[model samples]
Target chain A: MGLVGNVCVVGLGLIGGSVLRAAAGAGHSVWGTTASAADASAAAADGFDVGTDAAAALRRAAERDALVVLAVPLPSVGDVLRLVTEHAPGCRLTDVVSVKEPVAEAVRRFAPSARYVGGHPMAGTSASGWAAGSAGLFADAAWVVAAEDGGDPSVLREVTALALDCGAHVVPATAAEHDAAVARISHLPHVLAAVLAAVGADGGPLALALAAGSFGDGTRVAGSRVELVRAMCEGNRSALLDAVDDALGRLGAARGSLASTGSLGKTLEAGHAGRLALTEQRAAARTPLRIDLTAPDAMAALRALGSRGGRITALDGAVALAETT
Target chain B: MGLVGNVCVVGLGLIGGSVLRAAAGAGHSVWGTTASAADASAAAADGFDVGTDAAAALRRAAERDALVVLAVPLPSVGDVLRLVTEHAPGCRLTDVVSVKEPVAEAVRRFAPSARYVGGHPMAGTSASGWAAGSAGLFADAAWVVAAEDGGDPSVLREVTALALDCGAHVVPATAAEHDAAVARISHLPHVLAAVLAAVGADGGPLALALAAGSFGDGTRVAGSRVELVRAMCEGNRSALLDAVDDALGRLGAARGSLASTGSLGKTLEAGHAGRLALTEQRAAARTPLRIDLTAPDAMAALRALGSRGGRITALDGAVALAETT
Candidate 1:
């Protein structure tokens, strides 16, 4: 209900398309833009006011007090930023890019006048294009929001509200922390799938025919497009590489101790415990309260909320909240 | 329809319970034996004739012209084989163990007089125990069967017939071939999941909370009980270690190529192609014809069955068949 203005989503990819569908259904005035004329026309056919010119769309959206979302690939963020600065100087900007630090850096360098926030919704189906997206794509998914240094608080609030409007659970994080975390969880796993499948290629026809369940599930993400893999790996290069090293080190230790059944069993038992923790984390839910507070008043706000069982989560530099039972 | 008379399923674990359910539904008088008294009682509660004494069950089943399936853990295969030889002498025996070569070796060493055929039903749910099984668990799943050296041809045919009666896609493979194939597809994925989860243990709360569909699915098998993991790794030690080396080599190559965008993209692309091939393999199916032909008559069998567009699949060295479109 806090998101009162018009919305502009500047890509017709899966994430952008899903946001458009959800925002429009939530009664926000939604506008969409894509590089392809066919996609723009398709969006128009679907009853959204869509175009291929992102800047022009953002400019018109700015006049209506819109939140302009940059949903293109990572490399295109700088270009989208430049266009927004040139055409829609004072508008609020956010993005759906997977990696955040680089986008935040770009926002600081190119879009000085615009209010900018970097965001990523950890949600997608196997399919990529707009046709594969639906209004339910972001429902119950973790959506991270990262504010650029000295960015407007109102802009971050509006972006978080937009994520909430799409039925996502907002998880506020610094750009640096987000990049590092995803490098471990998302990026590394994609590479792991590729590694698993690469090995499976040597297995011949029998292996291919017998690979069911876990094999299919484990290697599912290796089927991701090259562009996406490139963007994710190159975008979070150091962290991704570090995570890979951590994995190989663990596996190497297991390999060294493989002949020792006791050691191998211990390592596997630890993994079972780790998987249990992951399952528990996914199942746990918290009711969140978005409250305005300065650093001095944050503890007081948290204390007023509860001390028995809850966590303090920062929304931005100036606001904090409680995630509670 | 080829499976006649009584059936006995030893162990009453996931595979054994499912076999009992399916065989009983297929109009066979089924008996079940489990090491755990609770499991035997539970199977009996499910309307099955069940007991804790596996040897007694097999001995009784042997007198009734039964097809006896050993569905115990991998290490117990040799002991189960010995029991079959001692108590159920000359009975038709098969197993649902994951590893085949070891089971075949055990049959030769301990159950030389028992008519033994090694089998593995490529079907299971995440849950174990008799409580988690259904009558339709093996429906349309790959069921690999391997014959012991100098085993009766009639025994192999009867086991394959039982697999078909359980609504499985019968895929006959040698013990050596089956062990190698499963080491790559099934066993390796389990260890891969374990390795991935081991690395994930080093990641903090943020990474775990944000992990969604792919991470969960990729590591699902890591949650398997440690006993099973130990049994699998130990029983198929050599092939599993080889698969691990192959995967490590592939991942090391990717890590080495991380600095080269072109190389990284190509590796990911190959993985994509591999995954597509796997998907196609899973989706592709055909009805098969069991054609009896000697080694000398193989070419004639192939010629007569040919050009009609089907694959030639060997059946236990004594016969060959066509898996037709």
Candidate 2:
């Protein structure tokens, strides 16, 4: 394992913390910042190198030529970018935000030199907080990387490398495409669950009791952190609104079919087709892996090789090799 | 365990076979019939006294002064009623059909002599067929009994006792009420799932693959037995249609709030209220339990108390207790 030299992970929450853990696990000198000293100390206790603040974290991360990963909420991503501009002026940076458009805009406005690539790890649960952090949470998950303005090839490669080190499949797309895809697949389903739960809630107690498996399963996500979903809906209003409308229209059409005694076979066929199509597209290719080898562990491993003055391979990227004798 | 007096369960599929297992387990002389000799033989081997010929099974059931349970589908319930009239003329009868109105009509049109009470056991899974049968399937489930005209009180009590022995809570209501209740709670959810699945299917392959936990859960029942759900839609068309319309209108309201950037908090508040309302309703008083005491186990227990020469203690119309010298 080679320590990642000066890796900066913002927002010390579950996703960011997991990234910190994975980077540390892979021998990366992880630098992390949080909204509070408590979270910073917590990350430090968990083996992350806690910086004085977000700006300090960025500066120290930059001095070490670290990769900065913005892992804040969609709404708070802009503020973090502002801090990045005031601090890490020349560092190659990327984000782990779920929605991409706003972060891309913020990066364009504030941190123009920070090679900003958008990243979304399609992983989560209904629970939140640092206690929910796990190093292997993102394993085998699809890590979507969105490149804006033909963004720095090195930054894209570096983030893709980071994702691979954490055992994720990397998929590249544009910011607009990512937002639209998530709106249709993720945002819409949450709205539908909430709506369905509301409907079943009014069905009377006996009906609810006899709900069996269907209602419970369907309403599971409705019980998710409402504030987080609300933030997503608000931050990505237009996209989510359109998604909701599209979902309702589809539901309306199906209701009409059921009402008219029309063929239900057609309805089921459409669902089957949709599910198969999504599967085929994702099975396109395997993800890539790279690492930084100019770190402590790789240098040590290099020294042990009884070799001199050569580059060592990082699991995520091809960082310049350390001289070994 | 003494065998229950002759019990006829029409239709040896999941629900019917399940009833057969529970009754037979309780020592009832349970007899069941299926569409094919294969099903009957399978049921027979599984401990039910099943016959390939429905007519003969019905006649034998009737000759034993048994309670016959109509366990066929909605579309076939009417034809089975006619068969009941010709073969099981003297048997007291009930049904285990999901919907109630059509069968209520069928019961009125045929099998006039038998004290026919409509029964709906609100228990099942996505699975069907005799192999899916389980003795404890009805445990803690609500068994809805619809009171019909000319249905004897004593027969209703007997059926309630059976529901208890099978580990079900009894809920009494009229056929129309039962139809309306199920339409809203059960049938509406199926339509919603179908609509959801249809949207994903039509959204192209990539869009569908991105459907995660919520979508899968919400649309799980969409892939249910197509014919059965379609028949439910058609047989209880008016109620189901009304429920679908009502659910759509509610969903439209939710969408409108999001579209207009109106109070989402208000819409969510309404949903919260509805859910609480359902929770309160289920905590109310429970319906009484009734079933055939001549069920084998009950009969054995009864005979063990000493056939005819016993000191009678209490007789609560449908049930009685006695002490043997």
Candidate 3:
């Protein structure tokens, strides 16, 4: 991966910290800016070249023609863009916001001199902060390299190279396309999970004790950070609302069929087929022979199985291994 | 574990097969009734005393004053109740149906002399059938033993004892309570997962590939056998509808709050709190110090960790050892 020089990363939160770490590990000099002095100290302790003055950091990086990554949340995108345009006049700009279309528009108006590519790495955990960041956080995950129609080609290339060097599969798309897709796949699911969980909570203590399997899995994202999810939903309000309406439409059909077995079964039948179609596209759907790692002494048994040859990904009640080519 | 002589298990599916195997391994004679000759032959091959004639098997068990477990699905419950009432008149009858109130009412109407206890063992996998059954399936799981007010105390005691012998924790509850709890926790989640999957499928192939983390998990139950889920939903219709409507009400509020930061953040804030409340109830909620097992060759690392002594559950990306007293 060829970079013009070093990189400038702002925000110093989980996403930005991870990007700084990954870039540094890839042998690219990274200058990080934190919103607070404590965050600056923590990042510096983590071996990052850090500062609290984002404008000064961007100016320094832009002098060397560095890529300035705005790894802040959606609410701060416009302010960050303004800072980048003022200090890093001709620098290549990229972002890690969940919603892309609004950022693209913001970039168009606020960062006129900067060549901008809106990007989002589709990987995260419930945990946040600089301490939670890892260099390998983006490994094997999708990084949407969302570009506008008239951006500098070299800037897009450099951003894509940076993402790939971080070990992400760069998905090329327009900002609108990325926004529409994430609204359906990411933002909508998070909000719905929260709703499902709130509903379960309303059922009282007995319902909580009995919650497992589908309930546990369905509401998994309800525990995500409120500020992050709220930003995602509010930023992409139209698309998120559209996705929710689509889901509620399907749910309404299922509800309508409640009184009739034939109709209810038909809804389930469609659902089953739809699930199969969607899941079959993913590589994880391949039925790896289950390694019975369910014993209480499961770790010992897994060792015995692994000695024979298998690649285990997730182990709960059982171990599932993807067959190596 | 004291039993009333031996046990008779009807229907040789995953649940029944597991029960039969477990009861037999615990030194009890288990006579099983299968719906088909192939099923009977398969059970016999597994060292079970199996037959295709349901009435004959029930009569034999009743004559010997045995505990007769009806481990069939919901649709077969009424027919099985008729058979037990006719042939196994005074037997202590219990069932493993997902719903309970209907069974309790059916027992009152159809099998007056047969002492009935409604039971549901809360354990399963994506797999089904006798081939997928294990003697330890019910181990460390909840087995709800629901008995009506007028049932003989001895019958409830025997049923609870059998659940214990099969390595389950017996949860004493009324049929209506069991049904309502299950509707919120189990049935409603399955239907909602299906709806979510169907909506994603409507988003087309791009959305499918982009679906990861919560999306994959939230829709995991969509792959469940359709008839089983349909039966679950239809059998507990009113309760399931109540749960769905409750979820919709929460979702509607979230929808209305899309424009305001205060309201949107409040929805997510409530969701975060709800998820914590629901998950904190489980013993698994305690954050045991994580033993990193992300290395492909992780078992060796686990063996070293195991030597330190604690309860080791399953190992995947990490070996989580809960601290012991």
TM, every model: 0.87, 0.82, 0.85
Error of 2 at B264 (Å): 3.9
Worst 10 residues of 2 chain B by lDDT: B303-312
Model 2, span B86-175: residue lDDT tens: 987767889988888888788878767778777888888768888888999998787776554445666766676677667775565567
Query: Candidate 2 residues A229-257, lDDT tens each?
Result: 66665566677666667667766776677
TM-score of chain A of 1: 0.87
Query: Clashing residue pairs, candidate 1?
Result: none
What DockQ do the predictions score, one after another?
A: 0.43, 0.25, 0.24
lDDT tens per residue, model 3, A1-325: 3632488998888888899999888888889998878878999987779989988999897788788898887778889888887888788888888888888888878888787877888888888778888999989787776544455555655676678678775555567766777777788788778877877776655566556688899888988888778777788987877877777777777777785543478678777887897656664433454444333543343333322222233322233332211
Q: Please write out the lDDT profile of model 1 over residues A136-241, one tens digit for every residue.
A: 9998888887633455566766777778778886666667767887887787788888878867766766677677887898898888776777777768887777
Say which prediction, candidate 2 or candidate 3, comes out ahead on DockQ. 2
Which rank order by DockQ, best down to worst? Answer: 1, 2, 3
Fnat measured on candidate 3:
0.56
Q: Which is the leading candidate under TM-score?
A: 1
Model 1 CA deviation exceeding 4 Å by range: A1-3, A27-32, A61-65, A129-132, A147-151, A285-290, A293-325, B1-3, B29-32, B45-47, B58-66, B147-149, B260-263, B285-288, B293-325
> What is the lDDT, from 0 to 100, of the residue B84 in candidate 3?
89
